[model samples]
Target: MSSILRELGALVIDADLLAREVVAPGTPGLAALVEEFGPGVLTPDGELDRPAVASRVFGDEAARRTLEGIVHPRVYEEIQRLEAEAPPGAVVVHDIPLLAESGRADSFDAVVVVDAPLATQVERMVRDRGWSEDDARSRAAAQASREDRLAVATHVVENTGTREDLRRRVEEVWADLHAR
Candidate 1:
């Protein structure tokens, strides 16, 4: 069997090419549920109807259970599938942006957080994405608190500097991880 890391490397290499198949039929029940609850509920492409989701289920306690009912199983199934397919001793580092929101960081072998200063994050969000300050702040706030993220992180990459610096830091960390 290939090493787990090798399997992971394969996945990472092809991740961008992995089409978003959650909306397709014959997927896990959770995917179906997410679609039923609100397709693209977690899309990074901003295809989801945020207001509609908020109105139907995002903000209300009643909707919380409903949301979880659809999302949790899907997440679990995906994890299971990946694990089954992964090579032995593979590190399954899921880049779940909302891991903190879902309170599931304990499941991973390690938690790595990449962070930038609030001012930097806001500036990038606004300048690159055209988000208003309030929108940027709200997006930031909706995730886990910075302190919380830092607290749980086994390793952290400070992203306040230049891209090259961040790249070098990432390379160092990756090398260290692979060396172990």
Candidate 2:
């Protein structure tokens, strides 16, 4: 990814880092954990009982909205900062996983969807993170569907390939971006 950014005369803007930075120091992680447990589960002490929290926090829609309100602004701030810092003639690829969720598509020149089959994605997630099938499926379901992602994508990167193939495609895209 770094190589492709260099080749395109562009700088890399990591969405995850931006999101993490946007959250108030330590609060984002707490908020994220609260979100996972379904809100309000974090006692002032910070120890989590996953089952108890999931039953209470996730069951309440108001709690979910409150959680989003706290984090979204920070994420937006980081995104704006990164966009402002992009170098001249740079094809800034903001790798925002929640672009669709945020309804912020118009902010980018183009969208690049990294495509892979659900099964492959699940397998990779499980192998990499030791997540169970249910966990993998839930995570996948949380993201936009394949068709929706493809619809929004100006370029579809089929990640179900060898590293060489992926690199080749990235190079091609980088060359095109450079030409523009």
Best by lDDT: 2
Per-prediction TM-score to the true structure, in the order listed:
0.68, 0.75
lDDT of 2 by residue, 119-160 (tens): 999999899988777777866776678887887877777888
lDDT of 1: 0.61
Clashing pairs in 2: 38-57, 38-58
Output the TM-score of candidate 1: 0.68
Q: After the best TM-score superposition of candidate 1, give how far the Cα of residue 114 lies from its true spot, in angstroms.
A: 0.4
